[model samples]
Target: MNIASKIFNSHSKEDGDFFLAMTRILGFKPRKLGVYKKAFLHRSVNKRDKKGNPLNYERLEFLGDAMLGTIISKHLYTEVPAGDEGYLTKMRSKIVSRKHLNELGKDLNLIEHVESKIPKAHFGDNIHGNVFEALIGAIYLDRGYTYCEKFIHDRVIVPYVDIEQLEGKVISYKSLVIEWCQKQKYSFEYEVYEDTGNDPVKHFGVKLYINGKVMAKARATSKKKAEEKASKRAFYALQDRISKN
Candidate 1:
């Protein structure tokens, strides 16, 4: 073979190996391997292309996010024809919530292929979902929308999207409580303060108030968690009214 052909062959073989590895994870052969590689590459690697632009999965993640939103929105629109804009949007958000996506990534063990300088253990739970989204982004870029949609259907919708179950799934209790309060024209606030108690870890306490009435109280390691816990309690307390509305 000529020099150029020999080099091409070597590169192709390497790409083939990557494709095989991804196939084992994805349960199907990918039409384009470059996207999967980009998905797994962590920003810490500091890789750059010949054009001097930094190369990582962040850009792909953005694309993947858009694609996922579009597909889920379409699914919701068709499945729940009676749902208005707000209802559909909230349903879509729940499906693509960070917690749900993180769980999906963990279930697939997508982090196993991440190329990062940092130790894997040091990485937070969000990394798995981030990589998974980046992979979707890559798939869209390499194989076009059709293949990307197919991959999402196979990996996400088929396995996870249950319309009835999702309707009751609470993506964010705090957000829900806040929305309900606003809709009902009730003043609501989450009072968060440093919690110094006998505990191994630092904690924050939250008191949820609705129209000057204390609805619920809770504590957690972080302000967000504290708020969520408080909101969850508030939800249960006002479950009857919330359900009616």
Candidate 2:
């Protein structure tokens, strides 16, 4: 059977019902249901389109990232007239951060619809944000910018956006720790080393030191994550001093 036939055979009216429910949640009806299906298709499936291009959400996720940033930036610009460029950018970053997007994706239970060869449990937290971005890409391709904007407003802005709360939000503990150290004129270092463990995934360990004293140590699958974990511990350890200075 051809791709069209296979798609039609695999998806029934019940599937459409489920998609319609998703559309209601997204506030937009997708014109090409196949696009949305592709949006949920994971890279592990190893599927390809007619042109021999990989059919997964990664490319769509990139598009959605830009779209989301644009919409959020516009909202921040209009909402805060007195705010400067840096302030608006930072606020937008906090709102559309990967962590926040992942949470939003999980809150919507998007993983239930994911089509992947890999076990769902094995997927990392970023999968949620990836699906969310793919959803935006599908909406943009199906209905265009107006519908896309509406969907973002309904699903993203109206429900979750709070200027005051976002202002206080921290996008990265690592950045915070670095800033605090710089402000206090204290020398700090993150000594990253390979972790020897039996885990399938290679892990990186980080020892965060401040002013020649060991502050915290952490390990994670990635160096950035390990550093962030260490920085978080360091932050709490020096929270009193940080607040004072």
Candidate 3:
């Protein structure tokens, strides 16, 4: 009933700090702190349970991803009664897009609580989204689906879901180019190779070919990013014709 009682009931001072941190983030006290604790644990620590099974946030991330998709789907279904299947699916993808999730995680400063042996700066951008999803997983485990849904609605949808703005958002330019190529009955290819540039990070170079003609070229730190960058350039180059589709 009281703060001291709540702390004594679950865990001591450490959990006390976690409790306050979670309260600030979730606007409510967590019933079970174990799940929440595991949610932020990175695999680098190599911890195992009594049964020798590995412990980390990855499994929780999977559960939270499913939960997030379900809640977002429900909201989209209710908000746009006239939306067809394709429209609704696209809308949901935009809402749960990795870029948006990363932004949400950063807003909550979720990384500050992560228990990783590696320096926080070295962690990839996806860490933010991963921990956020893990947090959702913990909420579901601790409080069940109702609370999980409430948390998503309160923290995610209510503040951020603007249907009009999201409709125009670009989740992946590569997908757009492929879709256009398909509709036009044109063949396309992405030739990716290791970048020879002097950049410190290993870079990838991509050349986008549409109808057997080189349309655009780009380089990035990853093949996917390089391809996407090339595709984005290709999209703009053919925007006039593509928009007619």
Candidate 4:
């Protein structure tokens, strides 16, 4: 085969593989493969359209996030007729939390499809969720809202969502600890500082103090993560009292 023919054949095989994979994931044939292509396109790839607009999954992630919230909110509203706005919102939040979304993405092995200049091993946990949302956006554009909702219902609601379980799930330990402290009229502080341990990566250490005593200590690559880790440890330590409050 000529060089041009070889290039065409290679592109054809890649497209065929992507189409089959998407079909299996979506449980339906995709009408347009181009939109799905953008779902896995990372900003690091530096692709642009004819109008010089950047083409990446970031915008699709935004759209998919909105879709997930709307669909999940509707489901919560319908299922929990007696639930107040606050209750419904909290349930919805639990269902669509970043941690939950990341789990969904990872379970589907979505990271394998991402096109990026950065190494896959260097990518963060959020990348999984980001591509998952982008795929939802692509579904919406390629098919429509009905298809998008169906995909979410199949992948998220049917397999994972359980109202009773979600009710007890903690989306943010830091928020819970802070709420408990405020309710009990106790002063709480997260003392965070750089603690570059012996590791090559910079780390932050956090001391979570409640009522002037150090409740828990933890460290992570970011101050927010360090604080949350400390808060989680404190929550377990004070679970008896915190649960009562």
Cα lDDT over the full model 4: 0.86
Question: Residue 71 in model 2: shift from native, Å?
Answer: 0.4
TM-score per candidate: 0.63, 0.63, 0.67, 0.65
Error of 3 at 169 (Å): 8.7
Candidate 3 on 1-245: residue-level lDDT in tens?
Answer: 99846796767788888887887788778878889989999999888999999999999999999999999999999999999999999989988889989977876788989999999999999999999999999999999999999999987997568685577777678999999999999999999999857543356899999999999999865677678779878988898665787
Badly placed stretches (over 4 Å) of model 3 are 4-10, 169-245
Instruction: For candidate 4, write residues 1-245 as lDDT tens digits.
Output: 84334534766878877877787778888878889999999999999999999999999999999998999998898999999999999888888888888877876778888999999999999998899999999999999999999999988897567685577766678998999899989999999999976643457899998999999999865677678779878988898665788
Best model per TM-score: 3
Quote the positional error of residue 54 for candidate 2 in Å.
Answer: 0.7
Worst-scoring 10-residue span by lDDT in model 3:
195-204
State which candidate has the highest lDDT: 3
Pairs of residues clashing in candidate 1: none
Between prediction 2 and prediction 4, the one with superior lDDT is: 4
Query: 121, model 4: CA deviation in Å?
Result: 0.4
Steric clashes per prediction:
0, 0, 0, 0
lDDT against the true structure, per candidate, is 0.81, 0.82, 0.87, 0.86
lDDT of 1 at 31: 60
Give candidate 2 regions above 4 Å deviation.
Answer: 1-14, 169-245
**Candidate 1 residue lDDT tens string, 1-245:** 84334534767766656665676666566765666888999999999999999989899999999999998898889989999999999989988999988977876678877889999999999997888888888878877888778888877887567676578767778888999899989999899999948642356899998999899999865687789778978987899775788
Clashing pairs in 3: none
Better model by lDDT: candidate 2 vs candidate 3: 3
